[model samples]
Target chain A: MLKDFVKNIGYDDPLEIYLSKLEKLLGSEYGISKRAVSLLLLQEDEEIFELVKKNEGDKIGVISAIIREANSHYSNPLSYIISERRQGEASRITNSVMSVKEKGLFNFKETLSRLMMNPFIGGPILLAVMYYGLYKFVGNFGAGVLVDFIEKRIFDAHINPFMVDLVNRYLPYELLRDLLAGQYGIITLGARYAFAIILPIVATFFFAFAIIEDTGYLPRLAMLIDQLFKKIGLSGRAVIPLVLGLGCSTMATMVTRTLPTKRERIIATLLLSLAIPCSAQMGVILALLQNKPLGLLIWLGVIIGVFLFVGYLASKIMPGELPSFYMEIPPLRLPQLSNILRKTGSRLKWYLFEVLPLFIFASVLIWLGQITGVFGFLVKALEHPVRWIGLPAQSSVAFLFGFFRRDYGAAGLYDLKTAGLLSGNQLVVACVTLTLFLPCVAQLLMNIKERGIGVGIIMSTFILFFSFSVGYFVNLVLILSGINL
Target chain B: MRKIAIVGSPNVGKSVIFNNLTGTYADVSNYPGTTVEVYRGKCKIGGEEFEVIDTPGMYSLLPISEEEKVGRSILLAESPCVILHVVDAKNLARMLMMTLQLLEAGMPVILVLNIFDEAEGLGIDIDLDKLAKELNIPAVKTVGTTGAGMDILRGKIEEHVKRFC
Candidate 1:
């Protein structure tokens, strides 16, 4: 019944003629209808071709000849013609059974949805969303308020002193005592950062992300940004992973697989590695430049500049087909509180499980580095770049912490800021450099996993030099221009 | 156990429907491309157990992206006892293209008009029985988020599976 009806619905001219001929020729059972098989074969589906070749044997030659003849009948590809026919039939059928009531041409949600995709309006709406959702909520409330409450009121005032006292009094061995209570102790630095700095910031970011995600705003953002993205050799579809990269680049790297082409995937991965700072780092940077509006502006400008500059260069250097964009924009819906909370909870769980160990492990490694003098040596080596970037010698420790995770390094800078070690210019330069720094260890491994080991290493190496160079240039510009924040 | 596979374009609430059927959370989101892996859980239809598989989203039979490849492979390899072609009701005209492809493939398909609430809110009304008769398949309306119309969907799934498998 289905095949007979579909055949009657039919494509124009020779395609319909070719389909019947191929249907008769494809003798083997393909688990699907012969008509469907014929259409696929005509469209030159690689998988279906191999299947038909295995099943049809010598008869494939005749089928190929028929396909060639059909192609001659149409200027467009057979797949396009066939798909158009299917779309026409679908619409015809839908019109028969589905009806729409007369109403105001643009409903509230529909108008908002349209405005969300308009270039001028959408861009400003996006900034407002980022300003309120990210800067105010995540940065001010999460990183500034909640972090201060946890890091200072709880961890610094209470937990660290309690832990150090407990460890110092009970621990017998001098080396063990220092390892547990010293500068880079797991409880002192690692656990503190995980719970105090990273936790609040990530939670707030995820909450904001979940709300925006549920509102169906991201796809509209994708549509709005498509023209810009096409210039970078990525389609609007790349927005999903890029936006997600703000939440966490490691997960975003995995999401890049969703991009249609390998070239798009590689470019997206490289951008995520080099430019997109995860929520933790972004929040901390926001907190660092909270009072210094111009410093924050400079940091924002530099990061966006690097994102576009690197993406443009990569798209040019890498040889591949330019990406095409097609995305389904789901209707805008009110953010469901349950869904938002559950999403945030699940993501936070994933972050805690994936990242907490790394934070503590980094602390242990730092402790080891200190004991073995390797940490001191690395910090010393990093100090030269730190000087070049116009940051303090102590800032080298933050840069080293950055290698573990971008957020951890930002957290290190937060400590330095609290201690009043860095000037406004140094804070801006460090934030700019650290934001563009190599992705965290989790993302590093994820990049290697998603891209091959070779590409991942190349990307990391490129980002390493690029971030520092950008930092050096920013510092030089601030000096040369004689404009200090 | 026989299997029921939920397939659709991305972000059409396939995972939410799967969650509704299996009573398991599959990370439902408003955006597309969330379900990167196949999720399977158990449910009972007509007093007989069935494995419900939630696949990554696919637009058509011909695969393009990695997610679509995974989805297309599930259809080819698993040979599900019943295929629920879950579609967003609001964009039925566009989404029905995939439904036609699935039907043309000669698989046992139930056209699920998911997100029906949204469609109705958009002042759209679909004649379910007429649509079913036109396509020569059973049709059901469902609001995947609130689990509305799920009982009817479950009834249809049982009927489709019992008749086919």
Candidate 2:
């Protein structure tokens, strides 16, 4: 049956010649059919060649002879030859078996897919997606509405006051009670920031992300941005991690492994950690600049400029050949509402579970630090640098919290914003600095786990210095240019 | 016990098929590269038990990335009894290249045309028998998300192992 099938296909003669030589050398010990194995061996299949060489050491001469003979038969490598044959056969079979009726209706989905890939129309669509999906929906609805409800109505009105009073009453030590209830208290501050502020923003971002992802819009976005990415030595595939970075940079760092080259991965990781503001940071920045469109644009411009400049610089510094990018574009489909909801729910649950314990632990640690007066000392130390950046000394705590989590610092900024401690220029500078600051503790640990401790620490240190330096420069530039908001 | 390795390019529903066969939850997503790690489970078929291995996606045998290296290593090391080469039906031309590579590797391959419903919706009509004959292997169409053609796949697996093993 196999021989008959092989004969009908009509590419059996050369394969047969190769197989006969292989079979004669190995005899009964060769378990695989000689023809199939020879094709792989000729293709420089290292694993198969190694096994055959190990088992039939004496027959290496004959096998090499057959490989040379096969090589002489094709100008291209044997792998290409074999693949072409197989593809030809596949297409032949497909043609024989399948018949198409009249062409179906013009698909709007395909047209939309094409439109999304066009640089002209697609650029605006991309901005629209970011503006509405991210700015209007996630920023305003999530951070403004949901966060306000949870942070103010729920935490401040109910949880914080109750926890502060309960702690003050039960704890005998004034210091310990103050640690649990006073400023930077575990329940009153840390837990409230995590659950009430960060959770709502991340949840909304993931929901929006799920919808966009399911609609197959991301790959189209990738295609649209490929030219821009080429300048940075990345391909459309890098877009996956970059987009996800907007949701969570730690996850994006891990996803960088999918990039075809190590250089691409490193560059991608650097950009993600340094420039791409995760959803929490983005939300807070949006809220901070909600009333100042010019400030928001400036903030956006600085981050984007840094992303491109640094990416371009890194690509030049990193020595490697650029990887060619080709991705299969899956047909666009209407995202099923149920699937989007399920994805959002599951991701939210996962995010909450992963973050809640960390937040609680952060609170307890802060409480201990406060009792030991370490928190006060660190805040005092940070105050000078905060003032140097032109931010008020009150911004010191936010910078410290920024080390724990970027979003934590943004939550601190939210508090400061509410208290009216920052002007328009100060808010812009602060946002840019925090956006470029060190990765959160969780991301640091994740980076160490994924990329090693040395690399992670180096990246973090680089980011810390770079962020403040950029902040200082931006402040200088603003003053020098005499741009007043 | 025998072993069956589920292998395919990224996001072709390999994990879903693995979950369907093994009764396990491995995070399924529309995005690729979700299954960065290998997963193993057991299933009973035709009064015999088998070990099922799920691997990361690879576009070709000649690997370019780390994940593909992991996938290719699994194929080389395990020498699975039956290699299930899962391909998206809508992408028959592109995916068949991998199927061809598997067959060339001299592994006992079962070609799984997954996402058949999507192909049908696109008005693609595949002649399964013709394809099977041309490749000299069993070809099965499956809508893995909905458990369609699963029984036929299992039955083919049993039949192949009985005849070949």
Candidate 3:
């Protein structure tokens, strides 16, 4: 057997003494070796510390004394010293067992990786990536082109009509028929939204994301954004969840589990809910504002400003240690085509499974509200704030739809735009408020699940109020200043 | 079933190796830190059926993030027959710390020096026999994405499991 083959890594004398002391004191069988647990305790790993405290009821005082003694002996933090020793051992082993030939030509991949992190070069590259990857491709091609083909040529011409006719013919009772196939019915609106408007946009975004992920540029981009993130009290490590928020805030909210501190997780979740629009919302917003340069610029400015401003305020108000960033940068490589396709396929599979059920549920809920006359009442109530933001009374319908899902609301606005109802300034204001509005039902549930009901409810309430106030303020400033786009 | 759990730092091809051994996909990508959850599948290697778990990436035994906790829980609970500590061969030094930790924990660990193609391209030649003897554990070189040396890795796992478990 290999039982006696365990490598014995000797730590410095003082730490080693504590490790032995802790190992002797440990009576309850931890699943791992007591040696590993003892090392973890020396590193001040909080969970292990608590576990040891729980397991060793009376021996804690001696363990604390030993830890303090070890701490006093080290000039640096114990973790730093321990990690350095481990690294030294690792490199020593590597040197003994590996040989290298001088293949020291310039690694173009390495150089390109640096160029991506360099501020002057990275800034333009980021813009080009955003403009092409997000705006032009997802906006023009997915939302504009593919959505028209699916929504108009396919759904409008065939599926919706067939469903409506089938409902009319089969169901004698009007209410039952309307619930499944009427104006806001599950078949008519929910399925259409999922397949026609949202699918094309989401698939395109995932395709772009897969390629970006394959190239290993995210961590380098993280390095570039680290400074700005520092100002917002987040380390560059928050970049992963925050950037993933662009794809889907619901998933990103869950991804915030990777954040180190509770403060960072809450702050990241708040920012994701308030500032980051999910892919469908992003695609629709791009399709709406891409042609209108001034309006699109204003929209961009508003969202970024809100993201930074709110993050800063939240960090200042909530007390925690400022975040520290440390992440390994994977080297850049040309993305493998097969890997890209497989990753995209898997992610797309996940996105559809998560979002589709929610879309259908939203439609059924809307139908219930409409038949019960609550939808009319809610939209009527929302119209006051809608008009206050310089939007027409009809815009309240879109705003109400936003409470269910952001992209659905944005799609409603897209319909309004095609009807030539909203002016440019009004369009900007509507976009700003909708982008900042409450998280979709799925995200709200995720927030509740992760952060608990009290925090989730409080967060959504604060977001609802702040988004409108900003919309009102932006509209007022633009109107009073006579800025025309 | 006797289990073989694959673990390493993020983006080091744990999922790829898992796929090669299990014939199932676990969402491989070039970016670091994408595997946020655990994935499991079944594999038949060396005439033995083993349950294989692909865990979320972890840096060290002292877990700082939730994903690391998820990865560590399986190690402490399931007590896998062989811990395949997959490391990117190019960054072998940086990754060896976790392998060292796993070994010190008295777990049965087989070092998977993965991405050998990239290491070879960088002119780094690893003497697998020497490395294995130095570390006092079995080591295999693999390019997980392409299944290079996967059979050797599997054979090593079955050998370790049969010997220890």
**lDDT per model vs. reference:** 0.89, 0.82, 0.88
Better of 1 and 2 by lDDT: 1
Report the C-alpha displacement of residue B75, candidate 2, in angstroms.
2.6
Query: Candidate 2 at residue A113, lDDT?
Result: 87
Predicted candidate 1 versus true structure: per-residue lDDT over B1-165, tens digit per residue = 788999999999999899899987787777899888899999977799999999999989988888888877777777787889999999999999999898878877888999999888879999999999989889999998899999999998877766667
lDDT of 2 by residue, B75-152 (tens): 766667888999998878878877766665577889999989888887788889988877888999999878999999
On residues A303-351, what C-alpha lDDT tens digit does candidate 3 reach at each position?
A: 9999999999999999789887888898787788888788778778887
Which runs in model 1 stand beyond 4 Å of their true positions? A1-17, A20-31, A54-59, A319-321, B44-48
* Worst window of 10 by summed lDDT in candidate 3 chain A: A1-10
Q: Residues B78-97, candidate 3, lDDT per residue (tens digit)? A: 88888899999998788888
lDDT of 1 by residue, A328-390 (tens): 888888988988888899899989998899987898898888889999999999999899888
- The per-prediction CA RMSD against the true structure, in angstroms, equals 2.6, 3.8, 2.0
Fnat for model 1 comes to 0.60
Tell me the deviation in Å of residue B149 in model 1.
1.0
How much is the lDDT of residue A63 in candidate 3?
A: 83
Candidate scoring better on DockQ of 1 and 2: 1
Question: How close is chain A of candidate 3 to the true chain A, as a TM-score?
Answer: 0.94
